[model samples]
Target: MSRLRPVVAAAFLGLWFLSLPALAQQEQMPPPTVGVVTLQPQSVPRILTLPGRAVAESEAAIRPRVTGLVTEILYEPGTALEIGAPMFRIDPTTYEANLKSAQAQVTSAQAALTQARTSFSRTERLLGSGTTQAQVDESRAALEQAEAALQSAEAALTLAQSELDWTTVTSPIAGMASVAAVSVGDLVTAGQADPLATVTQLDPIDVDMYEPSARMLALRDDIGDGRLQLNETLQATLTLETGETYAATGELVAPGFTVSTSTGAVDTRFRFDNPRRLILPGMFLRGQIDLGTTEAFLVTQNAATRSKIGQLTAWVVRDGKATQVELTDDGTWQNHWIVTDGLEPGDTLIVDNFAALSEGATVTTVPVTLDENGVVREQPAPEAAAETAPAAE
Candidate 1:
């Protein structure tokens, strides 16, 4: 009986140890080390991307008016030129000689005309006193012939001057000129070859893009209702083919006078500058035009999760437990929701533990770092650590 009592007593002590709260506390449990974030409202920039091409606001074709052998090319490719600068010389010596001969002919014609006039005057005076009628008629005919000869010579002299001027081809516009088609010493003819060079106006450049016709109507309505200002200086930025931002801002310009039926898009143009002249004409670029801005709740994508159906969602800690939210729209900015339907301001979301978390699990919250674009700046969780930690007994 005494032995039975010790056994019963030992069993009672074991049961008491198991029932104590301290024993429960001694059991190993999952750690609460997880990243968390709270939803917030802040102003964000709304952006849109469209394909565009850089175009010079103005351009001129450097062409000659008359046919000649290209004697010299003045401006090389990739050189800035001033207005009226001589770009090419087409053997001006020949044109100069022609001008001298035409001038000589004009002088000879003038001398002949003066002699004829003097002779005709003397004859008319004699006839008035008692000269024959045939002599009066002959004098008149000689005077008329001299005047016609003078007129012909004068016309030839004008032609020679024009031809001389055409010998030196000059730039019509001030800009960066490039020789696109020809070289020096080539025999160029009228309408045979294109311009020897092209001068593109680069100070004020144009960005041409197409927006849907419906958007145009909507924009017009917004402007009329004071939602948008038509003349407002909306900011524009450009991204080159390499995705680098251009160092210039553009101002919105007027739309094209016509719409394209085939494309259903209105041609939109913006004016900017190429201070460095790095932006070449007809190069494709990506642009972002600022629409109106608004405030929105944002959270980090690290705190986000996706369902089996590829839906994006987030785990938010509320009342000391992890709560899941299924985001209805796109989310990302400042590492959070740029646009969302499920999250509200002040809700705390977990950013670290994705695999170890369930819908109703509890976790400790921490401050999350996010950039201006709403990307999570926090260090990403290690997959190996997360995977191994779950297997710990």
Candidate 2:
């Protein structure tokens, strides 16, 4: 019995030693489950978003044409006024008195001129009837002097009339008027540094935006290379400061033909209809311009990560292993990265379980589905999952 016990114990010890290697192997990690998407080039609109400011199409400063006391303000401040509309009324009493004085001088000069002409005619008749030549010459000189005096007087009268007409200040344009600079009873003058008021055209306002010159050149090159196609009518979309899109679209009026020396950017202007007056001059806004359509590869943000040095990278799955790849992204489109390089069509991109993956690590890839909104969702890979499952004893 003692000999049989030793033999059985020896057999049990050998079996336990063999099972240790199998248990150690079982503790090793299996392939990590990962969600992946197949790369497919898509046609997407190339859009450039930039900051801009709304500006009035035309602006004019109102100043008094004559020096006088401001008697009354004719138009309401901040209200729309048409061209030739009265804006202010200066006291016209002084201007009227000046005009009357000028008229009196002109009347006196007319009487003098009539007298001179009569004398000259009588002298000429007397000279023909044997009167002295000296008398005729004196009458002719007197007529000339009188005519010159009348011309001077007429000019003064015209000046006075103009001054009188300028007493009533009018708007030079059709637009909204600013507040009055001078109140009633205040004496204002022509050629003053300060303006009486300001008018600004609001409807069909303009927006000025600046874009980097380098970026614009690059876009043009791409278009020339046939990599991108631009629309015939270049229109832009506006976003207000409150993040709401404006109802009316704007057309690009003046493209940046010249680059700014200081800012290294080009100035572009867009015109938008402002019937509701929602967009005001000097208001800051955002603008999106569609450059054209281009072929690009779209990947979810989760599938890509930024390195510490700001370089973008992603994991591509092939032959049941994940390979790390550096990527160059043009920009973001609908919450996804628009990759320009570092990936090709038919490459499997790891969308989820990226934190647990490394280069050359085996991964169990599941297909990812995207909805119309570009939202990524995981789908069960039944065949792949079943094949990778543990077999029954």
List the global CA lDDT of all models: 0.76, 0.89
* Tens digits of lDDT, candidate 1, 1-393: 878999999999998987787767756565475666666766655444556888889899877787888988777777888888888888778788999999999999999999999988999989858788799899889999999999999999999999999888888888988755777778887555577788989988999877777766865675576544332456678998887999988888875668888988777788888888778889888877776544555655555666789888777788888777787643244344454367778877677767777777666665666666655567455785487676657
User: Residue 262's C-alpha lDDT in candidate 2?
Assistant: 98
Which segments of candidate 2 are over 4 A away from where they belong?
1-29, 97-161, 379-393
Clashes of 1: 10
| TM values, all candidates | 0.60, 0.76
lDDT of 2 at 208: 92
lDDT of 2: 0.89
Every candidate's CA RMSD: 11.0, 7.7
State each candidate's clash count.
Answer: 10, 0
